[model samples]
Target chain A: MKANYGYMDGSGEYYITIDTDKCMECSEHFCVKACPAGLFRIIEDDYEDMVAEIIPNKRQAIKYDCAPCKPLEDRPELPCMAACTPQAIEHSW
Target chain B: MVTIGIDVGAKNAKILILKDGEILISKYRESGFDQAGVTTALLDETLAELKLTRDDITSICSTGAGRKAVTFANEVVTEVSATSRATFEMYPEVRTVIDVGAEEGRAIRCGERGKVEDFAINEKCAAGSGAFTEAMARALELTVEELGKISLDSSASVPMNAQCAVFAESEVISLLHANTAKQDIAKAIHDAIASRIVSMTRRVGLNKPIALVGGMARNVGFVHSLNAAIEDEVLIPDSPEMTAAYGAALIAAERAA
Candidate 1:
């Protein structure tokens, strides 16, 4: 289950996508702690599985919220993406 | 030397003209869908007021959300760099800057000489920015400025549970339906934003004297809430919205020199 958060605007597309299939295999959820904005939260799905999800309030504004981290010249690896050992998080920038 | 700095913010376009390190003139206008057009008009108007023209400007720099739209700018600077530079210039003792604008919030930690050491930002969430306050104010049937003043009269703590701006609006309406005092609701809104700002600032490590810039800095209620949230005094520039433009102008001055 790939959960996509954020939307596209005139500036660009920004999405914090989480692959729940990979997320369920992980024991420790580091992504929850790694996000400076506290954008990730753990929620139980209808299937009774716990997974990481982007907080609803942050879904629309990831472009601006993540601006300090995403520089134009040389985009460094994102902290949340780097923290997820399962490689479940991806940013569509 | 005369230089110009333009800040094309999400809601407003601000321009500053610096003459030999002093701010000669500053102008602000609503962006109104066309950021570049509004910015050019603002610059031209300011220059005309100063009896100058674009040719008189040694350099032109731009910053903020719509900075890329400033086609005529000689350079563009990041908001973090520009804000820190302007704050440090005004208050040399400031090591931290908390800027809450209409659409975003940023906390910057700076080293000596206003170099950005670290920073944190809350951009995607309206609940933590000035927009949240504006929405809440509209729900309460109060202007943004009126909301700020009324919040100062709040005597009791009314905690707001909603973390999302949309949810918070419904919450405010419910509070109003339940006959909760408007002053308390206003305080709750300011407190919510202040707490979010404090947490963001903590990520960068707060150091005093911390200066608050951007449009929200003018809100007395929000400033008080921030001071209480951080348990420390925070400075405010004379014209908080112009900090970014001032910093950009200063950079242009440096480049010209």
Candidate 2:
């Protein structure tokens, strides 16, 4: 299953897309540690497959929660996306 | 047998009672800190008003952000499916559905028979949802209802730059400091929210006629802005907030049958 999290607001569009097929294969759950905001969690999806998803409580504040990692100058690859070896995560800005 | 649908939304909990495929009664209350408790009491209160007993409800399907809390429910459905089912029932011609609740917003594309074709959600931020307008209203020193009413009086369009609700509140104050009209500020608030929703809807393909549901449908100011943003008049079902619950009831009815 492919799940899209985050939202588009007045300022801009911010979305985190996750491909669970790739996520389910990686047990390390590296994204959980990569994000300083603790945005990702390994949850049992509707299909009973354990996959990464944005934490529910964090859904309402994705823009601010993800900002510290994305400075205006010389921003590196997002820590969460950088750590995911399966390449299951993406950000739509 | 009657079937009941409960939607424990982010800000409101709604219950719909259906008998023989028709709505019998529906009610809603604030979700509050105790969603499960509030919903259970709401169901009991609604039943008492109708002089019906719990036994009359043979099945119950729950949906929304707090669906898992409804443990007594016979089944659970996602808000997307529930709203599409209800929208299809109301307007078969509607291929797109937009739902903006307190804390979230989503755009759903419905194919034949309301099966969800594709959908996009503005889930993580409160700015695309009713909660943004609510906070803006507070910042403008007006009630939410008053804010909606005053928005209609505006003749000017002012752009709001803030994406976060907290920052938006600060911006509203700055606009007031600049002596901007209250009505213009209110209109800007609605326009900003509508813009985000329209952008999200476009991603899923804005097939018309669009049906607008959820709590925000009742806000005429938002409705006006949304219609303008979509460039096509949107269809709003009667008592739009209950669409999700009504659809869940329909699902419960099917399961019972």
Best by lDDT: 2
TM-score of chain A of 2: 0.95
lDDT of 1 by residue, B105-172 (tens): 99998888889888877776687689989999889999999999999999999978776788889999
Best by TM-score: 1
**DockQ winner:** 1
Q: What are the per-residue Cα lDDT tens digits for candidate 2 across B51-119?
A: 998887899999999998887898999999999999988999889999999888988989998898888
Tens-place lDDT digits, model 1, residues A1-93: 898888754334668888989998887999889888788888997667788998886775565467556643356688898899899999886
Q: Is the docking of candidate 2 incorrect, acceptable, medium or high quality?
A: incorrect
| Residue B58, model 1: Cα distance from true site in angstroms | 0.5
Q: Which residue runs of candidate 2 sit more than 4 Å off their true CA positions?
A: A1-93
DockQ of each: 0.08, 0.04
Q: Which stretches of candidate 1 lie over 4 Å from their true place?
A: A1-93
Predicted structure 1, TM vs. truth: 0.77
